[model samples]
Target: MLRLGSPRRRINIGLIGMTFVLSIFAGRLIQMQGLDTKVYETAAANQRTQIEEIPAQRGSITDVNGHELAVTVEAREVAIDPSKVPAAVRQKIAAILGRQLGKSEQEMAAKLAKDRTRYQLLARDVDPVVATRLLQAGVPALSTKKTYRRLYPAGDLAGSLIGFVGDEGNGLGGMEQAKNTLLAGRDGKQRVETGRDGQQIPMTSSQRTEPVNGQDVRLTIDRDIQWAAQRSIAEQVRKSGAESGTVIVMDVQTAQVVAMANAPELNLNDWRRAPAASYVNKAAADVFEPGSTNKVITAAAALEAKAVTPDTVYQVPDNIRCADQVLRDAHAHKVESMTFRQAMAQSSNVATVMAAREIGSQRLHTMLKAFGFGSAPGGGVPGAEAGLLPDYKKWSGSQNCTVAYGQGVSVTALQMASVYQTIANGGVKIEPQIVAGTTDTSGRYVPAAAGKRTKVVSETTAKEIATMLESAVGVEGTGQLAAIPGYRVAGKTGTANRYDAELGRYEGYTASFVGFAPADQPRLVVLSVLQKPKNGHFGGQLAAPVFKDVMTFAIKSRKIPPTGSAAPQVRMRAGQ
Candidate 1:
C-alpha cells in the first residue's frame, strides 16, 4: 500500500509472490505422492487390467458301443475393431471380408461404418480352417476368438434322443436338456494387466482360476441297433403311408433300452429347420389303447386270481353282451367252445372279456398297475406320460368290460414294451434305463444305478402266458406274420381305433406289435407302432414285418442263439 519505491523493488515483490505459488504446488505434489498414493495406483491398475472368462470344454455323448453321437469341435469367432480400421482401407477391408464370409459388400461396409464401436462380430462359429484363412489375410482390425461348436456325426439317427444345444451353448431338448448340468462345467476367470494395444503386458502381475472340463455322458443306446430300428420303422411308415411310427427295443433281463427310434426325425445338426412336432419323443410321450395286445393283461389277471388255467374252456361267440356294451371278435365267427389258450392265440375279444369278468374289477386294476401302466416309466425320462387309467372305484359297468379288451385303457409304447419285458423277465418288472452313466475326467466309465425291480406275477403264470403268446405267432393264429424262422417268437398284435376329437368318434387306427424272440429263452423285447396306416391297418399286416426285421437284426447283432425247438402248438378248433 505504501509503494513509494523504484520499479526494481516492485519487481522483487512480484518474484516473492511467484515463489509462494511454487511452494504451494510442491506441497500439493508431496501430499499426492505420499498420502493419496493408493487411490491413484488403484485407478491406474483399473485402466490397464481386465478380467477375462475361460470357457470349459464340454463333454462328448456316445452310444453303448462308444459311437460318438454328439461332440464339441473347435471353432472360431471373427470380430473387428471398427475404430481401428483406417478410413482409406475400410472399403477394401469390407469387400475382402464380405467375400470370405459369404456376405454382401454393403452389409460388411455398414458394419465397418460404425467407427465408435470398438468391437463388432463379423462371423460366429466359423470353422477353424476358414478362420485361419481370414486371419492370414493381414487385416489389422480383424481378430479371432477360440470357441466350440456342437456336431452330430450320426446326423438325424438319434436326433430326438441326443438333442441339440442353443446358440448360448445350453441344452435345449432330450438328453441335452435332461443332463445339462452334468455336461456344462463351470467357467473360470483370469485377471491380466494389458497394454495400450489391449495385449497382455509382459512381467505384469496376474491371477487365474483354472476351468474344469465337463464329464462325458454314455448312453445305453446301441448305434447299429438304433440305426436298424430307425431304418426299418422309417421304411415301414413311408411304405405303408402311415402318419408316424415308433420302435423300442429293450433288454429283457436288464430292462436297458437298446434302441428307441422314431420316424420323420429332425436332423440334430439343424434342428431349427424341422417342424415343432418333430421335437417330441413319441415312444415315451404319446399314449394309445392296447387293443388286443392288452388281452395278455386280462389273462395274467385271471391266472393270478386262480380263476382259470391256460386250458380253461369258455363258450365264446361272434358277439357277447358285456354290461351295457357289446364286445365282438375281430372276425365273424360261429358260436364255439375254445380253451383260454386257443382264445388268446386267436385274439378273441369275447373270450378275453369273459376271462376278465371272472377276475373282477379290483384284481384287473391291480394287475394293470403292476404291469407298469397308469404311471410314468420314472427313469428320469423327460416328458414321460403316465397313461390314463381310471381308478377301479370310478369304473362303470361297461368300462370294466371295455378295459378288459384294451378299449378304455391307454398306455405309452415304452410302457407296453415294459409290460412284455415283465413277462419276458419271468414276471419281474424292471424299470427301463436309457443313460448308462457319465464318464470321469480320466475316461473311466461309471455305470448308472440299477433299475427298480418288482414282482408282478408268478413265474409259472408268466411262462403259461408266454406259451399262449407263442401260439398266437404260430401259423394258425392271427399274428402269424410275427414268427421268426428258426426262433419261436412270442407276441401279440393290436389294432386300436384312434379317436377323432373333431368328429367325436373313432376314425383311424394305431397298428402295433410287441414281441420277444427265441421264445424258450427271451432276450429282447421289441415293440413297433404305426399311426393311421393307409395301406394296412392291422398290426399283424403292417407292424409285424417291421418288428420281424428289427428283431432279426437285433438277434444276429446280439449273437443270440436259436431255441432249436418248434413253437408250442395250441388247438384253435373246439376239437383238434
Candidate 2:
C-alpha cells in the first residue's frame, strides 16, 4: 500500500531527534553549573542555612557596696522540631512539656501536632536546670536554646528604685529605665548550615559576631541603710494604718541618697503582679503640703532677711484674720506674748503668720525658690516631680499668710529633705544623687559628676536656725518624740490638710517629720512622711518616731560619732 523508507534514512532521523534532546539537556546542565550557578546555589544555601540571634547579657545593677541587686543569669528557650517527632510520641512529648513548662496539656499537644513545621517554640526563659531535665527525657526533636533571664537577687529591696525589665529585656521604670541605654548592650548573630534533619553540619563554613554585654550600674544606695529604711517605713505604715508612707535618708555632705523607701513596695521579681501605685518611688515623686515642716523655710527666710530673731517677741493669739479668711492655731489658746523660738517650737500658726508679715510675700517666695522648691531634684531618678510653687504676685491675701506657715504650696519629700540637708551642710545646697557611677563593658569604672552645689544662706543664718530647730525637739516642743538618746536632734513636725485632687477639696492630713542628727554637726538627714493616717494624725506622734528610729540606725551604721559640743541654750519664752 505504501513505499517503505530506507533503513539508513530511518536510523538517521532517529539519531537526529535523540541528538536534539541530548543537546537541550547539555545546555541546561551548563547553565546550572556555570551561567546561573550563583542563583541556584543561593536558593539551596538559603534552604539549608539558619541565622540565630545571640543575646547579649544585660548588665548588673549593684549597691554602693557591690551587693548585686539586679543581674542577668544563664537560661534557655525550649522548642521542638515537630517534623522530627514521631506521631505516636507527640502526645507523650506534650505531656512532659506541659508538666514542666506550666502549659496546658491541650496547648502543648496542639503545638506538637504540627507535623509540617520544623520548629515550634514551647517556652522561653526556662531555667537551665529545668531545660536539662527536659532534654534528658529523651524526647525526639526537643531542643534548648541559650538565652538569659533577669534576676533580682535582693528581691523587693530597692525594687521601685532599681525598676524592672520587660519581656524584650528592656528597662521599664526607675533607674533601670533612666539608664537603660547603658544597661542594654548590643546583640550579635550566628549563621550556620544545617542538614535536612535540621542538625548543624560540623566543620562547615559559618560566620559569627560576638555580643557586647551591657555596662554595670553602681548606685550610691547603701544596702544596709536601704533595708533599714524599708523595714521601718513598712512597719510604721502598717502600725499607723496610713494610706501610704515614704522615708528618705541622705548624706549631708554629698547629698547622696543612702536610702529611699516607700510603703507597699513593688517586688522586682514579681512586678507584673504588683499594683500600678506600688511602682511609684513616692519619696521623690509624690507631692503634698509640707505643713509645719515648711515652717523651717519661713524661719530661714525671716532669719536670713533679719526680719526676726529667735528672741523676737510676738503677741500670738488663737486666731488671726487675713483678707477674707480667718486662720487659727493648731490649739486654742488665749493671747500670749511668746518668743519667736517658742512660737516655732509650739508650731503656732498665728505667730508664724505674724513673723511672715515682717518680711512680706516677695522675700518669702525668693527664699522658697532658693531652697529648690518648684523644681525637679535631678539625681537621675526617673519620674522625679517638680512640686508646685506659685509666684508671689499671684498670692491672695489669705495665701500670703497661709503660705508662710507651710500651706498654699506643695513639695516632694526629697525636695524638703534637701532643704534640711542645706541647713545640715551649713547652708550649701547640693543636688541629690542616687547613681554613683557606671562600670563599662571594658570593666572600667566611670564616675558620675559630683552634684551641683549652691549656697542658699550664710553659715551664720544656718547655725542660728539649727539651734532654733533644736529647741523644737525640747520637752515643751511638738517634736519632743523625735529626740534620740545621747544625740541633739533638730527637726520640725508637719500636719497639713491633704488636698484630694479627685474630690477637688481638702480632706485628711499629711503628717510628717524632717530632721538631721547631731544638730551641732549634722552628717545625715532623714525625713519620714505619712498620708491620711486613721490611727493617729500628728507628725510628732506618727512621723517623728519613724525618723528617730531610721536616723539612729543610719548614724550607727555609718559610724558617725556625735559632736562633743552640747546643745546651746535656746530661749523659748521672752524672759528665760
lDDT string, candidate 1, 1-576, tens digits = 785769898899999999999999988888888888999999999999999887777788899977899998888889999999999999999999899888899989999999999999998778888888888989877888777888999999878878888878888988888888888777778999998778899999999998887788989899999999999999999999998999999999989999999998769978989998888888888888878889898999999889999888899888988678777888999898999988988888889989988978899999999898899998766678999898989998888888887888889999999999999889999998998888877768899997999999999999999999998898767788888888889999998887655688887899999989878799999999998899989999999998999999999999999978876555656666
What are the Cα lDDT values of the candidates? Answer: 0.88, 0.91
TM-score, per-candidate, Cα-based: 0.93, 0.95
Q: Over the stretch 17-81, how does candidate 2's per-residue lDDT look in tens digits?
A: 99999999999999999899999999998888999889999999999888999999999999988
By TM-score, the best candidate is 2
